[model samples]
Target: MEKLDVLVLLDVSGLEDKEKFEKHLKKEGFHTVPDEAFVYTAESSTTTFSTKAYILEVFKKGLQKNTFLDANLIFLLNETPYPAYYYDKNSNDFELSESKEAI
Candidate 1:
C-alpha cells in the first residue's frame, strides 16, 4: 500500500454554520490544521484514484448538507503534490481539471 498525505481546503464563508462543516470533516476522520484546512493520511494501491474518490465522496456529502460551497483537494505522494479534485459552484460538484505541477 502507498501512503499519501491528503489535504482538503474548504471555503466555508458561504456556510450557514462553519462549526457544522468543521464537525462534519472531523467526524469523517480529517484533522484540523489550525486554520480551515483538513488533513488526512490515506493508504491505497492507487493513490491518485483513491484520493479522487475520497474527495468526490466528501463533495457529495457536503452538497447534500449544503455545508461545502467551494473547495480544493490534493494529495501528496512521495512529497509531490497532485490535485485530486475541486468543487465548482456552477456544477455543484467536484471537477477534475488541469492542475499545477506537483511540488
Candidate 2:
C-alpha cells in the first residue's frame, strides 16, 4: 500500500491554550501548516491499521481530553483537496460521508 497523507484542521481562534494544543499535535508527529492545519503522512508498511483510521482515533481521543476544543477536523487522504472523513463534534466520531469517486 502507498503512503497516505493526512491533514487535520484545528480551530484555535480565540483559545487561550492554543499553544498547548499545537504542542500536543506536534508531539503526536504532526507538522504545522498554514491556517491552523497540521499534517502527517503514514507509510502503509509501518502500521497495521489504515492511516486515516488511526489518525481519526488519535483525534477522537484528543478531543475527549479537550486537547482540541471547539474544533472540527477533517482527514484528507493522499493530498487530495477533499476530506475522506469529517469529525462530528456533537457525536464525537468520524463520519465517512465523502464519496470515494471524488478522490
Candidate 3:
C-alpha cells in the first residue's frame, strides 16, 4: 500500500488524558503542526487507500480507543482530493464531514 499524508484536526475539549493521547499520536507517527490548535500530520497507509477503512481499521481499534474517549477526530487526506471524514467517541463509524467547525 502507498503511504498517505493525513491531516488530523483533533478536538480534545473534554479529554481527560490529553498527554496520553498526544503520546499515542506521536507513537503513531503523527507530529504536531506549527501554529495550529490540536492539528497533526502523519504518513499513514491503508490497505486500499480508503479513508473509511482506515478509520475503522486503525482509528477505531487503536488511536481512538480509550486514549481519545472524549475527543473528536477530523481526518483530511493531505495529498489527495478526497472529502474529509469525521469520527467521534460515541460513533462506531465515521462519515463524510458536514460539521463546519471541524473543516
Q: Pick the candidate with the highest TM-score.
A: 1
Q: Which of the numbered candidates is closest to the native, going by highest lDDT? A: 3
Greater TM-score among 2 and 3 belongs to: 3
- For model 1, residues 1-103, the per-residue Cα lDDT tens digits are 6566565554334556656655666676666676434444433345567656775686457555755445665555556665556567787766765665322
Q: Any idea what lDDT model 2 has? A: 0.55
User: Worst ten-residue run, lDDT, model 1?
Assistant: 35-44
In candidate 1, which residue pairs get closer than 3 Å at backbone N, Cα or C atoms, i.e. clash? Answer: none
Flag regions of model 3 displaced more than 4 Å.
45-52, 55-70, 81-102
lDDT score for candidate 1 against the true structure: 0.58
lDDT of 3 by residue, 1-103 (tens): 6777777675645555656656766775678798897787777676435654554354444445554444456666755444555554466655556754554
Count of clashes in candidate 1: 0
Between candidates 1 and 2, which one is better according to lDDT? 1
C-alpha lDDT of residue 23 in model 2 = 68
Task: State which candidate, 2 or 3, has the greater lDDT.
Answer: 3
